[model samples]
Target: MSKTRQHCFDFGVPPALTLLLGLWGITRNNSMWRDEAATWEAAHRTIPEIWSLLGRIDMVHGLYYLFMHGVFTVFGDRLYCLRLPSLLAMACATALLTLLGSRLVDASTGLATGLAFALLPAVQQYAQEGRPYALVTACEVLACWLLVTAVDASNWCHWAAYGTTVLVAALLNWFSLLILFAHAATIALARTPRAVIARWALSASCAVLGSLPLVMASQAQSGQVSWIPPVGLGTTLNLLMTVVMGALGAYLARTRLASGSVRVSLSALALPLLALPPLLLLAVSLTRPLYQTRYVLFSQIGLALLIGAACHALASRFRRQPRRSIVLAAAVALVALLPIEVPLRSAGSRVDDVLSTADNVAAVRKPGDAVLYIPAARRDTALVSPGAFTGTRDLALIENPRQSNTLQGVEGTPEYIRKAMLTARRIIVVTDDNTSPPASARDRTKEQVLRSHFIRRYETRERGRKIVVYVRRADDRAATPTSRCPCFVRKGSTPTPPGVVPTEQSKSNRTQ
Candidate 1:
């Protein structure tokens, strides 16, 4: 008897449903990452505080906050539910890309475009993340569709849609302004006559100028910031690869040569037009202060479209040289994909890993035991208290009176060493090897401060997250060293200074 072969359901479902299912799977088990945890806290602001909060910390994502205010009303702020909106937004983007690809290029191109976006690693990563990236992606496709439609004619409605879309896109993420530059550059390469190009350019220029006020406000609020160094040939090539062939963006120059259609090539070039200008500016900023990879994501649209074109152009290679194209695309896609999914899976897997670790370590009620954050790593695998491992009540349950205003990443956080040591039944501070002096220095002075000053209890490392528990020896209790005591400030500053209390924290702030 012949085995019954199962056909994939993606073939039968409408693009819209397939798109949603794909996004849902990507987002399904992704526990909220740290930055996303922060966003959830901010977006659920009360109506009275919403306006003030939007202007203060979040100038660009104001419109999204307003939408999330609606999300909070129904979903009531669970992490998965809060992130549901972003996944839905990404699904909309996949559907729109399919329609746009089909309408702008051809049916096969359109079908592939939707499928490509649906499976793309970057799209998958952001769809799972609990932030505004998916929403921005959605706005990007809609804006591009609107702009392309408007350029085809002077349809007043399309132009109006273009304006509204531009404003909403900008509000979702300020970098959406880069779309204007992409449009300008693409129009120049368009086979459209110079007269027509000039007319379209003028129209787009007006639309961008109209958005100047909001853009200027955002710029002033953010202040000029940059850290990325000048992008060399290597970085440029890497970015180009990521933009054009989905994960193929990693090996841009290495990929096989293909003859891209004029439409596709022009579209591909739009990516550099959108991203390169800002990237170059960021490179120049390396000398002064401002570049973060995340801010420039809106530019990836040009890259994504370009990659779709490249994929379409090069896909036939897979048919002829089945071994070559399949092998190359597979290897590149796998390498590019690991950096995202692997990390996500590792982090998610730790939910159980941390729980298992908790089972073995009995909570020893030693009086000096404290929950110390050794050297204070930038992040930890799990945030919840280790039930048996720490032998103390979870800080979440602790009546932390001052948590209301405890800003994340503030300089003074690790200063709680002294207090945690004195109070915790089994004191344990977690840290990685980050704080040790360079090997050349071999500073025993600093090393002694840790070993002699703080009594070591237990140390463990699993999958890069480290936990080191220390106890304040009974003799050391009399010393009352400021380093390990609560309210005991680090040498330079007091833990709770005179005027540092919360100004007017509400009930919501207490929950954090």
Candidate 2:
């Protein structure tokens, strides 16, 4: 193969494959989980509304929300529009990784590295998500590539670009700042020259300084991530496996390349990139619960690089039989990954499907019915599918999400909530299926009121969500068979209470 054709194959194949994988079942059967619902709600809001929302919560995702607002404006607010940017960003990340591998090692290693990255479960998962992590991952790779280039040439422009890219990634998610620690470890391991090290320090410092405002602003909203659990046995095992795999691959590739052959050795770069950020995040999580694997999604790049290097080493070892060996390895990997890949594109794959919950709500709701969102964040279901809740009142809500510039909207106090619940004959409660204790005093209060004041009449579980109907104990006994309420009563269903009338308007509205 000619150099140009080889270069094209190396750079082109991985990203194209990534795009293909991303586009396959991109909608997840038309389901939008709560997290994606948050993105959709935020992006659909006016620009000023998004800005106002950032002031109160999710400041870290401000830039991404704004970017998506533009995307929605241009392409219209379809699921395709919501997730396409992430797909394209992952594709770009794949291309950048290919370039990084080619520049640092051989073309074969670059091709393998890019292909590995594209096929990674984490990468594939995020690539199809509507969130900003994939974009952050792309920026992280671009910054890494620029760092390699800057180290080689020691140019101001390269350092500036690296700093700017880091800033952008941090703006997308402040946790991405953890990558700087990994980069520092890479420079130290490579025994970079004093001048280049100084330049790196300056660039990194500038990036941090640029991101300081978001850091400070996001601290006030730390409660948003208060739900993140502390690292545990499962997390430890996953991290251990990741590190072991990278180390084994690094060991395999060590003999094939001289440390002095490249300005920064691939092992030096890939090892810390794989291991440090997640380890550091988990370490901090010990004192303050802040660890979530998705936060360090960029670390997958390191693993992919190591895998590529390992493949290159194996190819070198079996020069005459390289094709057969590579084909066998690829087949084993694909077969192993097939089960996971198939489910990832399914509606039930995510924690909770907001659209499914909305459909359930629409099916059972009547015009004058009241609704409650336990833990409140489940209000995202209503936010994304407002039509499902057309005539229902949010009994505990003080203001709607957009009006309050909050993700879940502000809620009334416990006393107010209790008083409001007393007025409703039938209430719909949307909550998770898990029996875990409520996360907040408000949620506990909601649960307590439901248990004490209302009788659980009907309940159904769908896609990790539970929609339960609670009828007031006083109204439950005054039931008539003539009422057409769908609260699934086993023998004699609870009828609409006197003065609480069901209207054709609600029925017609739900149909629309």
Instruction: Give the candidate number with the greatest lDDT.
Output: 2
Q: For model 1, how does the per-residue alpha-carbon lDDT over 436-511 read when each residue is reduced to its tens digit? A: 5423111232234356556544444432334454444664464344453433212221123221231221122211
Worst 10 residues of 1 by lDDT: 1-10
Residue 439 Cα positional deviation in candidate 1, in Å, after optimal superposition: 19
- Model 1: number of clashes? 26
Q: Whose TM-score is greatest here?
A: 2
- Candidate 2 regions off by >4 Å? 321-328, 439-441, 478-512
Tell me each candidate's RMSD, in Å, in order.
10.1, 4.3
Error of 1 at 327 (Å): 17
lDDT, each prediction: 0.49, 0.86
